[model samples]
Target chain A: MSTPRTALVRLVAGREISVKLRDKGFLASTAVFIAIIVLAVVVPVMLEGDTPEYTVAATGHAGAVAEVAVELGGAEVPGLPAADITVIGLEDPTAGAGGDPVDEAFLRGADAVLSSDPDGTVVITAQENVPGDLEELIAAASSAVTAQDVAVEAGLSADQLAALTSPPQPRIDLLDPKPSLPVPPELVIVIFGFLFYFTVLTFGASIAQSVVEEKTSRVVEILVAAVPVRWLLAGKVLGNAAMALGQVVLIVGAGLVGAQAIGEGDIVAQVLGVSGWFLAFFVLGFLMLACLWAVAGSLASRIEELQSTTLYMQLAVMTPFFSAILIRDEGPARVALSYFPLTAPLMMPARVATGDAAAWEPWVAMVIVSATAVLLIGVGARLYSGSVLNTSTRTRLGGAWAAGGRA
Target chain B: MTDATLAVQGLTHDFGQRRALDDVSFEVRPGRLTGFVGANGAGKTTTMRAIVGVLRPDAGTVTFGGASMTLEVRRRIGYMPEERGLYPKMKVAEQLVYLARVLGVTKDDAQARAASLLEGLDLAERRDDLLHTLSLGNQQRVQVAAALIHEPDLLILDEPFSGLDPIAMDAMAERLRDRAAAGVPVLFSSHQLDLVERLCDDLVVIHHGRVVAAGDARALREQRAGRRYRVDVGGTDAWMPALAGMTVVGSGPEGTLVDLDESADPQALLAAAQAAGPVEHFARTVPSLAELFAEVVR
Candidate 1:
């Protein structure tokens, strides 16, 4: 016979794989979900409008550089006086002589850098503390600078320069149609969306399934005979978490590998730090939902009642998704959801991915989520041990709590 | 060496306000097969779980090897729960070896032991089949083998005969008897009273989480023998002869039953019955375990 530790691992892993693979509905759901996310990413960016443009400003030969600025910014080259945008041109009056209030004002106010040069040099700079849209702004400014150089080299006449100055509006059609969210970090949205949805669906069912299976099969009697309720819970939590961790690695690694394989370089790193935080959320999320799942399983006398009993667990999972979706664009709610433990795994990662998360937010959110996870695991173990053997009618959440005090 | 492989005292477990097992006590000695007999929900499983240290009793202690059950004690105990659990996807051989490993056996030894067990149970051919693919009886054999692969010193099997056919039951009984003979303490609960009677030396009967009766099976059976008696007659007759303190349990045409008074002399009771008719047959019998169970449970 195998060693107990190996036996436990094999039993757990074997059981998990069987249950996971046997349910075609689950596999199908996961497949369809992955397809939806892939399409969701692929469809929007391909058919959507101009990859949202951002304006840039250049100084030194101000007017001479405006053309390059617009080309570089990947937006319309503002004619003479730009509308909805003010591209100030400065000569530094005293070239490198310390304080020029006009240059300083425009430098402090600019939103992003486009390009830089000296004499006829184009110095594209942003005054804003952070780039509003760095990728778009940088792309536009580079294109603008390239167009200016072409015109200057060609020795184009004033009218010719003006005509050429309009810097080709990029006839701007991307034919290959790769989704705009092209990086692995960009897939974070899809990763979190898929994992958050599927993890809850998959792992939540594992809990309920194990509970109901044990009850229906009458295995709970034997199990409770040998180990503390806590050990079972711990073993299960570890087992299912391992499963989730595997999925997390698969999805993340697959996305990273897929992105790199397709020439989408180094996107995983963008989301690596955030993914670590995502795991913290997953642990917390699992803890909260595992409690509900176990409670649901205990109340269910048979497998048929398992689905019905898991309704509360379903609702719990949906709360975070609904919160994430509805107040997603709102910063405070996103921040709140990020730290709310149950919602953090789903919401905080999205906020971090979208660049909406503040510096201390993820850390604070992690602390709160971790504390909540540890707490729920303890409470879940207690409730599971208490009510697992009570094959009576459905146990209310209160009953599990009451069970706690009984022991 | 410990005389009793396991000893449980004042074990109690409660779920909410209701107690599932209350102050139950029992002892299982090496070289003995102890039967835990009870109807469904009679706290036999609860008591066993408490003894195994799986379900912590509210007030009690279960000692193995003369000390409280610890991880070490658990490793040495073979437990077959009523609820048969095997990883459905795992091959039977793989499953057994894994269990052996969990009990601290080396992989090679565990594998060899598992093979022998499978061969013994006549499941060597199906060793590679996933547990779910096996018939229920075969799966049950696998469960048994899994429990015994490590050759534990203390074996606790809860309702081991729940689903086995008669032949399988006999095989299981033989296995248990063999193990007990080898100085392993075997404690098992079963609704099959006849099997328990045939296989067990001692019996612990539980009712509603309490030990109702616990002692040598023969002694317990003898306790209720006041209702047993034999009558003698020369020929078969329709009428049953009545005697003092005796009611007719069964009567042939030739004779009547005279229940013996516990305080009365058996020789006098037999003489009284013989005075009414020519003596032919004389037999005093205690109820079978089944009858005993019915009486106790009722």
Candidate 2:
């Protein structure tokens, strides 16, 4: 058996959820947001056009050069296409040549033409811009072949010659070990930060708007008489919070699925790794702002008056969002923001994404934000209960506080 | 069914420097329809609000059934504010059920009650429609239903009949009587003195945040009526003005309206009128509620 207050709160929350779910504006905006996330994920995969096939028409020694180029260019670059090059033999260096080397290469059914002069000058021609990796490969192959010829002429033994002519690769040793999880893309981290900011701000405004509507319409009079004021406030916050959380889950889930489908599994792992922290921070941060929004809403008797009354609260939610954007790279600023209750929701998740904050920082920020949220609820509930039924011109915060104390 | 008496004692409230309710006191007895009547801005709404715990009185107590009005007590009280309001976007039936459930009724019971109330209010067809879509009179009926959905122990309605048509008013009056018959104390405020007088078993007239007069409706009328009389003589009475301690207030073909001093005898006046001519009719005239209200507030 639930207490009357608890039961009433649940009823209120249920009503809010049902009403919002039926609201076409809310549904449409959520659909639009989901569409954007899906498009963001799917568009890049669609634009990564089919793999190109490269044919190099080579004559004499240059044919050997083309094979070496293909071998070196096939090595993987993290986010670019795989190299696929085929070589074709030319019996005479100038047999199929014309004044325009590019035209001659195209007539020979090749992407590029490669030839070596007897004096050791190598010429490469292409009809259009060559891919950066393909150019690098051709340069490296020509240098390697020249070095091998010199090594053989210097009278080195077969083993020594092989060692001298082969490419020299530098070995790397990190002083600190790399993190087990790959860093999330900076764009992805920024997206999460904005998502937190937009959801909290929009939902917080909605809570205030609803409060003012109830007050202006005078439905709150009946509501307050039927139940405790705190219960109504609790119900509203919980209801809107549930809706906001659902939206966040949908967006985050869609992003993960899209990333995985596009073969960006590394991003998926990184997002999942910080998702717990993001959710915790989002919940606490939204609660903290939502309480104040309830207070601001109770102060205004009409929806038209809401903007003037809730200006300070709006600024409070926006300040941290803009701060995160402006001072994103400043370690000290991010550290301070991650621990500050107001900014922590926006900054902490970003720091986690960038790997700038240590493991313990998020926990500390969580504790601080949660504590602040509890305190805000206490004060916010008092203000709400006190001023909710007073349908005067407008309720002053100071007066409401005094009345709340007595209440 | 428990009969509860709602007592508001010395309730005082202030809005900033101005007094909204000043030492107002009244009682809504069990199984009685108590009409709270007052002029506009006379603090009737404020007193009602204080009784239901919507506004905390600065210095007073509102007790229901001999205990202070707590959340538990308020749960059993149905209140409608002077400014009628409901969630415009919500369906009528859904809104009623929500209000009922919040007051501790079971979900199924709440739904049933909402349906019954809407049916009784002749809003069965509009139950599924959003509240704002109804005409103002019909919406007012829905507001009344919302108040009665939980079948509260005490019903406090402020200006419940303000926007209602004659038929709707009668329906609301009938509902109030039914609630009172079921042992629920109903306190409602209205500026319409005629309807209040016709519907109320008890009358509490408030003025300037104070209870000016309160008692049984007939008793209040009789009390305000005082020693006034109307005597119909068979012919034009020439000697009526000569009576001591008595003044003719008005005279017409039917009768002469007379105002007598408190010590004057009504029997003596009737005999004198007969002696002058055949007394066709004689009776004490009771003051109407509007007249009583004007006299008291004045």
Output the number of the DockQ-best candidate.
2
Task: Please give, for residues A1-407, the per-residue lDDT of candidate 2 as tens digits.
Answer: 23566767888889888978998988998888888998887787777634556888887778888988887667653333456888876534356444654466677688778888898867787767776766777887888788877887887788887677653567878897546564434665567767887787778888998898888778998988877788899999999999999999899899789888978798788788878888888888888888889899999988888989889997897788888777768577778988899988878877877678788988888899999999999999999877887777799988888888877
Which numbered prediction scores highest in TM-score against the true structure?
2
Error of 2 at B18 (Å): 3.2
Worst lDDT run of 10 residues, candidate 2 chain B, spans B235-244
RMSD of each: 14.3, 3.8
Writing each residue's lDDT as its tens digit, candidate 1 over B207-271 gives 88888888889999889665566575675564365555556666666466666565656676667
Segments of candidate 2 deviating more than 4 angstroms: A45-50, A55-66, A77-81, A86-166, A177-188, A328-333, B1-3, B233-246, B260-281
User: Model 1 reproduces what portion of true contacts?
Assistant: 0.31
Cα displacement (Å) at residue B24, model 2: 2.3
Docking class of 2: medium
lDDT of 1: 0.70
Docking class of 1: incorrect
Error of 1 at A316 (Å): 2.9
* Model 1 per-residue lDDT at A337: 71
Pairs of residues clashing in candidate 2: none
